[model samples]
Structure formats: C-alpha cells, structure tokens
Target: MSYDNILALNPRIQAHATLRSTVAKKLDKKHWKRNSDKNCFMLSQPNIYCFEFVEKLSHNIFETIH
Candidate 1:
C-alpha cells in the first residue's frame, strides 16, 4: 500500500515517525532519485515492511475515529 493509504488506515502509527524517518533516510541514501519524489522521499520499502510486519498494527491504530 501507499504511504498515504497506510497513514489513513492508522494515524496512530505515526508514533513511529522517528523510525519511519530513519528508514526513509536509509532508502534515500541508496536511491537518490527518491529524494526528488515527494512521496517516496518521506517513505521507503523498509518503512512499509516494518508496518506490515506488525500483526493487526493497522487495525489497532485505526480502531477509533479521528
């Protein structure tokens, strides 16, 4: 899923923003072009994978209406 999709699904997951930023930074180092892509610049495969790895993490995050 896309970053926005993930964020929309689980706004609470934003608590992990520092971790996400670290992952994005690593990705940026490997793929310079991603830095030019606004969306890609803020997210990365590792970041997405990290979220996916946690079971029910999304559902728990979005359980309440914002």
Candidate 2:
C-alpha cells in the first residue's frame, strides 16, 4: 500500500494521533497549564486565542474527510 492510503484507512485515528502529538509538544514547551480542579488543561493564553488555535488545527487535520 502507498503512504497516502495508510491515513485513508483510518482518518479518525490519524487525526487524533496528529492532535495528540501536537499537544504533547506544547505541553513539553509549557504552553499549556493543567487545571487540577477542573481535571483538564488550558493554554497559557486568552480563551479566544486557545480556541482559535485548536479550531484551526482540527480543521486542517480533518479537512480532507469533511
């Protein structure tokens, strides 16, 4: 099989893997902060900026499927 066909076989997994990898890098770089009370993580920036970044990444990764 070709390289292109690998992602075609499972786009969701591929998209999630891409997102996870990006998030991991950001975490290592201390771009995201953990919220223990909320049991989640937030970016070290304004809410709008964080939302836009995530939205753009998601859009780019899943654009082909959509």
Against the hidden reference, what TM-scores do the models get? 0.18, 0.29
Q: Distance (Å) between predicted and true CA of 58, model 2?
A: 0.2
Report the lDDT of model 1 for residue 3.
90
The lDDT per prediction is: 0.62, 0.67
Q: Which ten residues in a row have the lowest lDDT in candidate 2?
A: 35-44
Tens digit of per-residue lDDT, candidate 2, span 14-36: 44433458768866766455643
Model 1, range 3-48, lDDT digits (tens) per residue? 9888788646454444457778878776876435444432445576
Native-vs-model 1 lDDT?
A: 0.62
Regions of model 2 farther than 4 Å from truth: 1-46
Worst 10 residues of 1 by lDDT: 35-44
Candidate 1 residue-wise lDDT at 39: 47
Best by TM-score: 2
